[model samples]
Target: MSTSPPPLTLEADAVTRITRWVAVGALLALIALCLAWELWLAPTGRRTLVIKVLPLLLPLAGLLKHRLYTYRWVSLLVWLYCAEGLVRATSEPAPGATLAMIEIALCLVLFAACAVQVRWRLQRAKAAAALG
Candidate 1:
C-alpha cells in the first residue's frame, strides 16, 4: 500500500532555521546601530532619527515570526541600507564612515540569511509536494 506525505507547514530545516534567526538578529543589530549612529554617536543634529528608524519597524513582526515571505521581501528592502552605507562609507568622515561600514556588513548578513532560508524552504516545500 502506498502512503501519502503529511501536510506541509512553514517549518524549515536546521540550516534554514539558523539562517532565519541570523537574519532577524542582523536586522535588529542594524536598527540599533542606525539609532545610535544618528541619535547619539554622530547625531546628525536633525530630525532624521525617526526617518532612519521607522522603515525598519515594517519588517520586524514578520522576521520575528520567521515568515518565509518576510525573508523574501526584506531581502529586497535591504538594498536601500546597502546603498546608504556605501555612500556614507565612501564620503563621510571617521566614525560615521565606520558605522556605515558596520551597517553594510549587517545588511549583507541579513541578505545572505534571507536568501538561503528562502531557497531551502522553497526546495523542501517543492519536494514535499512532489512526494504527496
Candidate 2:
C-alpha cells in the first residue's frame, strides 16, 4: 500500500561528508587563530583572553560524530565569533586586525558548512517521511 522514497544518492552522501569535514576544519582553524592571536602573534592586554578558544573546543566531539543537533546549534554559535571578528578587524591595529579577518573567514566557512549540512539532512528526512 505504501512506497519508500529513493535513498540519498552517492553524490548527496559525498556532499554531506565534505561539509562535515569543512565544518571541522574551519572550527579547528578558528581555534588555532584565536589562540595564536591572543597568546603569541598579538597578545592582548589580558592573558585571560586566551580563554575565548575554550568554547570552540566544546563542539569538536559532536562535530566529529556528525550530530545534526550539533550542526544546528553550532551554526548559531558561530555568530559570536563573527561578531568579535568584525569588532576587532575594524578597531585593532595591523597584526590584530589581520588575525580578526582570518577569524571572520573561518567563521563564515564554518557557518556555511553547518547550515548546508543541516538543511540537506532535514530535507532528506522530510522527503523520506513524506514518501514512506
lDDT of each: 0.86, 0.94
How does each model score on TM-score? 0.89, 0.96
Tell how far residue 111 is off in model 2, in angstroms: 0.4
lDDT string for model 1 (1-132, tens) is 445765445555568678978998999999999988988788775848547778888999998897888989999999999999999999999898999999999999999999998998788878778887
lDDT of 1: 0.86
Least accurate stretch of 10 residues (summed lDDT) in model 1?
Answer: 1-10
The regions of model 1 sitting more than 4 angstroms off are 1-3, 6-12, 47-50
The TM-score that candidate 2 achieves is: 0.96
Query: What is the TM-score of candidate 1?
Result: 0.89
lDDT of 2: 0.94
Please identify model 2 stretches exceeding 4 Å from their true place: none
